[model samples]
Target: MKNIKIILGLVFLTISSIGFISCEGDDSGPATVDGPPVINRVTLAINDSTTTVGLRENMYRIYGENLATTKEIYFNDTKSYFNPTLVTNTTILVSIPKETPYFDASDELKVVTSEGVAVIDFPIEQPAPEIDSFSPVAAGAGEIVTIVGSIFEGLESVRFGETEAVIVSSTSTEIQVEVPEGIVQSYIFVETLGGVTQSEQAFGFKFVIYDDALKEGWWVGGWDGSEDFENTEQVKRGDFSIKRIYNGGYSGFQIGNGGAPLPISDYSAVKVSIYGEQNVGNLRFSINALNEQELGVILQVEEGQWNDFEISLDDPALIGENELEVFSQIVIQELSGNSNVIIYIDDLGLI
Candidate 1:
């Protein structure tokens, strides 16, 4: 046979060339190798500004292949659907889903991977500035108020009730604070970042009351230190007068040109007018400020019969003296013995 039929055709071509090299070494084994997964880098984190409105927690990272099988993530156009968890298929841990109720300031974030999607462009700031209404509703300690409505731009503080107000100027709407001196009817809060806004009503400032008829040569005397007293000659019939008789026991009334020195500051308070008879015993009318070494209670003439007395000099060394030498005494140390009471002293001004 022709050499055994050419040795069976060379052994059937060496068994079909060893089954074509074992199907090319099992198709170059390594599990069907396809390639395409070296993404190297991608990261993002959020919160530069998003002043409240709803869910907004972002964090993402992807460094290559199977990125833990990333699912989806997109911000701005909103859409984050993730469930990835594969720290080393080539790292991937994304979670950004909770921000959708309006309040986007130019947002941009994306990361969807089956092999595609990856973007980042964050910038969503703005929302931190609020304080509305405040304009002379009543401010008096030192006054200087003006804080009117809506976002004032980063303005950090402006408080008055607890103290700390002296902004002076700012604008986005308005701000001019200064009312800080133990504010009494308080309520004025204005901090920024869009949180803390108070003052819809409640503001007060203004207090200073010191009075006692104008002084400068104030005259009216008679108690031996005579300027020749005669308010109709200390009446004793029809007007009932005694001129000056403070019966605490020591007696009263003595201001004389004979002593000549009475100007006692332009006045802070002191006004007298009295007429009493019923055996008066509790009569007091004092105003002695000869430079005040401490002794100024001013006026108090009470025994019931005719009354009109106003005295007040809040005590500050008896206020602005040019010559200051006031004196209008009366108060008989609660009459101890010798029943004799009758009072009458009129006008005597300096307020």
Candidate 2:
């Protein structure tokens, strides 16, 4: 009986030892993962960098396990320049701080994590559009002027000083905007996504208000034949008349036939009063210089009331060798169809 009891005790001790070894084998701790924290997405918001406007708020999302409750965000470099705030364990909210070295539109964003550091490739672009030039600078207050310049693709607003001009239309390279009311100054500036460009001051003086005596030497002409010489004229009242004819035909007026062309070489232009009775013919106005003839063509007339026209003659040839003469014969001709339309002529001058 003593021997049997010893065998049972020995068997019980062996079973307990085997159970302890099995428990030790199953004691492996939790598995560990090795890698950088997975980032799902990153976002940024920016205001116009060119102007004094402030920056806007934006978001960036981070994903994966082991994300610490505290984190750091940066821009451009890892030196903690952005100083983003930790909103949550998996998210961060940051405001773009005032740039030290000046904000560049090409700057990017980056983030740091407890697992590792990750960078965002997308750059933050915030720029103000600019305008280089505006056509018809002296337009009426309500006139539509075309604003031209670079980087007009994303225009936000256009302003004429304090007043906001109405944008008529926009394109990648150009924008058509109308002048606002209560604008007295001829000079103005245009604002865009890039910057502002100043416009040349408009000539606000009324051109037609000048006295008739001030226009003593102006020339006037038209191809339509009228009973009164002064009524049917197209070119402004100036020294020379340039008329155009159709189908290889020619028409012109000479200031002085007796002298060797007018001698005044520094005259401004030939002025005439003209209206387009028809669109089929062109008018040519020629001036006789001592040696060469300078000529210009007028094709901007439509059948209507008389409009004043001016053509500059800076060329040295149109003036005569002696004093300029006023008793010159004006010639007219039809280039194609002999419409027999006569252009009127009056008030020809050199000044």
Candidate 3:
């Protein structure tokens, strides 16, 4: 009886050991996850590190549970493409496509998975408007001014410096607004749902010498037969630009005022737009006494493209020996011994 009882005890101990081992090793893998994915957070990589911003065409990491079976992703209802290789059970790597619309978007990032769909708040923005060029850069108050650029959709405001003007019309690539007083000589600004854009070029000039026509109190020397005060062929700013054909090297023109001297303190630079037909020698731009075309600052000229020269008032060559408040003369002469060239000048002014 004692031997039989010992054997029974040993068998019972062996059975308990096997049960313990089976309980500890029962995990096959992370058990087949069931139910919808739970989005914990979303993150982005910037500078090869981690940051967070929903920029178009930027890669992002979606952190959640049971996300390995992601099937589709939508940025504000615009379906986006993703790579399956970058997906995992707890995270997904995806990129927001550029074609996704942001203007008037729902701002919801929706992810569709095999288990279920998960929607999260993802803020996006439209691209800022780009100002390529604006027509009638110089216009009077109440005049219709047109702005040309891209991504002008959902415009918010159009300011000609400080005062917001009335938008006459708006399009994705263009906008027309009425010019306001006191802003005709300041930089134009545009705003949209995304952000604001300031024009690289000012709207209108402060004091004009020649636009469609020469302003009052301004005159041209019209030196020799080389100056065509009105040339319609390659007008840069307005209906006309002073076109000059250099007879040879060192030939140029001059502009002066009889009674209207510009206030030197009110301006910071002398802006002149020039379009060159060929590589001409440097232009010596000078401000001196009436008819003085001898002393000035030298500026390089480019061929086949328009160059805008804003000779600042700080340049010693620009203000040498000349009265500041009585800035009336402007002379442009080519450097010594330069070849013959043709050039068009427009928007000669003080700003």
Better of 1 and 3 by lDDT: 3
Better of 2 and 3 by lDDT: 3
Could you tell me the lDDT of residue 315 within candidate 1? 48
Cα error of candidate 3 at position 211, Å: 13
Name the top TM-score candidate: 3
Q: Against the unseen true structure, what C-alpha lDDT does each candidate score?
A: 0.50, 0.46, 0.76
Per-candidate TM-score against the hidden true structure: 0.24, 0.31, 0.48
The runs of at least 3 residues in candidate 3 whose Cα sits more than 4 Å from the true structure, single-residue gaps closed, are 1-33, 47-53, 183-185, 205-351
**lDDT for each residue of candidate 2 in 1-351, tens digit (9 for 90 to 100):** 999999999999999999878765532322243556444555333321222222223333433333343256555442333333444444444555434112344354455666677654544444445556777543445678787765565566777766788899998668888867634334555565546656554422222211222233434343333233223234433333333333223433333344333433433444445544454355545443332243334434445545444544553333423344432433333443445444434333333
List the candidates ranked by TM-score, beginning with the highest. 3, 2, 1
Error in Å for residue 147 of model 3:
1.7
List model 3 lDDT by residue over 23-53, tens digit each.
6564322334577887877877443454434
**Model 1: runs farther than 4 Å from truth?**
1-106, 110-168, 171-175, 178-182, 185-188, 191-193, 197-351
Pairs in clash, predicted candidate 3: none
What C-alpha lDDT, on a 0 to 100 scale, does residue 347 get in candidate 3?
Answer: 74
Question: Between prediction 2 and prediction 3, which has the larger TM-score?
Answer: 3
